[model samples]
Target: MEEIFENRGLGLGLSFSGLNGIVTYYDYNLDDNQQLHYSLELTGQQVGNSFKALRLTEESTDMQSISKSGSGNSLEIDRILVSGTYRWFVDESLVWGISEGLFYGAGGGFGYSTLKYQGERYKYGSQHIR
Candidate 1:
């Protein structure tokens, strides 16, 4: 503990930031009694962080030394999404405007999504720890 008391240097830093977005959608009427709706979405993200330090230290033996250390990390990600829906009207005509009350037949829907990820860590310089 006496040797550690001879060195007096400390440093700390932290930062975080990000940006994300992306998508599209569409709807079509196959007929007066049939409707088809579909949509597509895409997204990509990248992030990085780094830490570095340089300092001077002294020992109880009356000796002086220089210390250098550094570390870093990085990441990348990509994603995709697709979806679709189909609706049918059995009653055909039962409205005068709004299209939410004509659904009376069986319908089918489907969706698909995918994601890709990559990451890496790096270190530089060197230091001797007590």
Candidate 2:
């Protein structure tokens, strides 16, 4: 179970600290609440300290080759996603002190990600000389 979390978080460009960090989103209502809702999303997370993706153990094999391969540096990545939404309320009614509402919405988000790292990188069968 823990490995599942680590893999998911790392895949999303996050360190261990980020996993423990609080993840929250904010929403805002426009001047008029009936017809529309607009929100400016500002979300980000940063690791306070440095960490290594691949951990080494005393019984690990080929540690020398692995150490010599990857450069000694921390990798940093930044991702920005901007989006907007438009929703229409079909109907709303109060039942048993609960508000029952029907809404239709269409929204999309575009994400631009940038990576900055000074180390060896590779993909597929190719190996980066640098």
Candidate 3:
């Protein structure tokens, strides 16, 4: 004899002030008895003055899973990641007076990630500027 289970999910988002964001979360179990769970978020924004505009964005994700091994043992894994960036730009027509319809910008960002499995943890991260 055998049995089965199923699951489904849906998500929605709203934004204001030239900024938008969305988040989603889901969890489900597989037929083999593995369990999975995860969440994700994303956001973006743009603000401007007469001379320049600023743009920003960010994203994050987390996930975990547990499963039974061939030896009938349970194993679990977890992971997380986060990152963001920003930029400033000026219209080429305003700086060069050529009206070629272009812009220049500089940006920077950073990111970090971590993972855990079988009583051990690992981490990674980075940063940048331009």
Report the lDDT tens digits of candidate 1 across residue range 80-113: 4566667676653555577645675443445443
Q: Looking at candidate 1, what is the lDDT of residue 100?
A: 48
At residue 5, give the lDDT of candidate 2.
Answer: 18
Model 1 alpha-carbon drift over 4 Å, by segment: 1-20, 45-74, 89-130
What is candidate 2's lDDT per residue for 1-130, written digit by digit as tens?
3533111111133222222221223334332233333332222223222222233223332211212233564444444455556665554442323444555678776766555555656556867796
Q: Give the number of the best model, judged by lDDT.
A: 1
TM-score of each: 0.33, 0.37, 0.22
Could you tally the backbone clashes for each prediction? Answer: 0, 0, 0
lDDT of 3 by residue, 36-100 (tens): 44445433211112112223222211112234444544343322223222223344445665644
Q: Of the pair 1 and 2, which is ahead by lDDT?
A: 1
Candidate 1 weakest lDDT stretch, 10 residues: 59-68
When 2 and 3 are scored with lDDT, the better candidate is 2
Cα shift from native, residue 60, model 1 (Å): 44
Write down the TM-score for model 1.
0.33
Q: Which parts of model 3 have CA positions greater than 4 angstroms off?
A: 1-5, 8-10, 13-20, 31-34, 46-130
- Winner of 1 and 2 under TM-score: 2
